[model samples]
Target: MQIMRPLYVDPAVPGMAFTYVMATGGGVAQADRYRQDLVCGPGTQALFTTQAATKVYRMEHDYATQRVHLTAGEGAYVEYLPDAVIPFAGSRFHQSSVVTADETATVVYAETVTGGRLARGERHEYTVFTSDLEIRRPDGTLLAVDTMRLRPEDVGGVTGPGVFAGHDHVASVHVVSTRRPAQEIADTLHRSLADADVLHGTSVLPEACGAWTRILGHEQPCVTAAVHTAWDAVRRLLLGHPAPDLRKQ
Candidate 1:
């Protein structure tokens, strides 16, 4: 639970501040519980990301859970794009995130999960992994909801047709904004992945709030690149500029 001072690292969007969240412990352990809350003031531009990938160690007893809440004020633009989460064998983890955005604000959120430590041949060896995401207006009206529950021991398993579909990594990006038409946003997202070597899909969010995309790939690099492509496209479309390299080693 540590945070680094915000920096103005994006030349394209000099007004946007970049902040990095760091974990005191090396990774999550059994019986761990964590929570995070992020708020963007009116007309502020900010981007929040983790310093490194989150690792969930093997658990012998209870499970680990994380909760996150994000709020965007009027005319604010916010982005929360954390690194991927990797679960070790026999680990169990759950995460829930809720985003509240004003009618005039815009928000971009992204998340990625791996099958496990691919180098160690730990593919979906975890006991269970789950995540839930909800988007809402300031008045509490819901805009969209996404839920994922993966259990390799289940009957059909997570590698079935509609789920991960045999992919070792999966990523998702959600954009909530009024700067562009929802369909156009979806189109931009779809076109961004056109040349990427991965399987992906895009659609407009409920109530025409924005657009979202889901990507699947066998390797982490490919999946990550696709997600970045989509994010860059959305940035160009909404902010009229390309994404700046955060220079994260």
Candidate 2:
């Protein structure tokens, strides 16, 4: 893993630093184990993103796993918005993310996953793809937990009514913050995607701490646009500013 030097690209928020994380191997291979820990000190404002989409290559034997732990200190504002993850045929992978935040901190986290290489007509051909996410307070109090297990060979398959619902791409955004009322945050998220081209839903987080939204669509562009809309809404509500263009290549 390589982290680029901090860049001040957002004139609206001059104090916020933007950093990009790059994978030296370009993609994840079979039998790979990766871990990442990110800590934002008190009163700091930062955003971290990946240089490109995470591609999980086809596997034959063992599976790949990635673990991420994020901690936000008091009054810190941190965002981790990475690109989509594309699992090739026969790939098996699992990812676990744990977020620990102080009551006064604000953290925005998002993730996107595609069914497969849609251009190549590969859809849900992977053996298994699972992810677990947990949000907790600094004192170890659990706030929320989300788990996803996608196995095309399962009893009902991933395209079932309650699962992907035949969507090719899925994305989610979570905002953990005390800067605004939870219901207001949820409403903002909902309004952002009310007329969008994708299917989405928003709800307040546990304990009325913040809000979150989930988006699903057959096209990647539609889903990605909806995700960005939700994020921008939340940013405007909490930070009094809009989301900046990362200018990613």
Candidate 3:
């Protein structure tokens, strides 16, 4: 496990503290388990990200698991934007992230999944890839839940009619904010992707707290670009600030 010092990169948003969690000892491997927790106090803003992409290496034994927990207090704003997650051939991995926030808190989260090392002719070769994300109020009332269980071998591969067909990368963004109109935000995000070379969609979440977006493309850059576009829209609508370049390598 690696933890790095925080940085003050955004002059326009001085109130939002940014931190990087460096993953040491290389990337995830077989039989590895990781847990992380983050808290944002009332009226404070923060951002969290990894130093690099999370690579799930090939495994010969048990699979790996990663769990993350986050808490945001009233009037707080938080964003968790990690790099892409690359699952190498013969890998099995599971990840879960849960966020508990007060009714007034706002959050933005994103994830990207690639079709393995396409240049090495690796695609849909992983044994299993599972991810679950949930958001809830401080009282434990669930506001939203998103789960993905992909087993290419059992499902006849990741590419097929109606299933990530012709797409080598996928990305998604979730924005939770009670201060903005959910449908309007969704419309704005949808418009932002009108010229992108990808297949994407957006919809408001339950109870109109916020919205979500999903995008599929043939390359990682395309999907990530779409996600960034959506994030820009969210930032403008919810935070009234422009999206800052993270400058990730």
- The numbered model that scores best in lDDT is 1
| Of 2 and 3, the candidate ranking higher by lDDT | 2
Order the numbered candidates by lDDT, best leading.
1, 2, 3
Better of 1 and 3 by lDDT: 1
**Model 1, range 17-110, lDDT digits (tens) per residue?**
9999999999999999999999998998999999999999999999999999999999999999999999999999999999999988999999
**Candidate 2 lDDT over residue span 1-249, tens digit each:** 889999998999999999998999969999999999999999989999998999999998999999989999999999999999999999999999999999999999999999998899899999999999999999999999988899999899998688899899999999999999999999999999999999888899999989999899989889878888888898899999899988875
- Please give the CA lDDT of all the candidate structures: 0.94, 0.93, 0.88
Arranged by TM-score with the best first, the candidates are 1, 2, 3
Cα error, residue 234 of model 1, in Å, equals 0.4
Residue pairs with clashing backbones, model 1: none
Q: Kindly indicate the candidate among 1 and 3 with the higher TM-score.
A: 1
TM-score of 2: 0.98
Give the Å error, residue 15, model 3: 1.4
Please state the error at residue 228 of candidate 3 in Å. 1.2
Residue 91 in candidate 2 has what lDDT? 96
TM-score of 1: 0.99
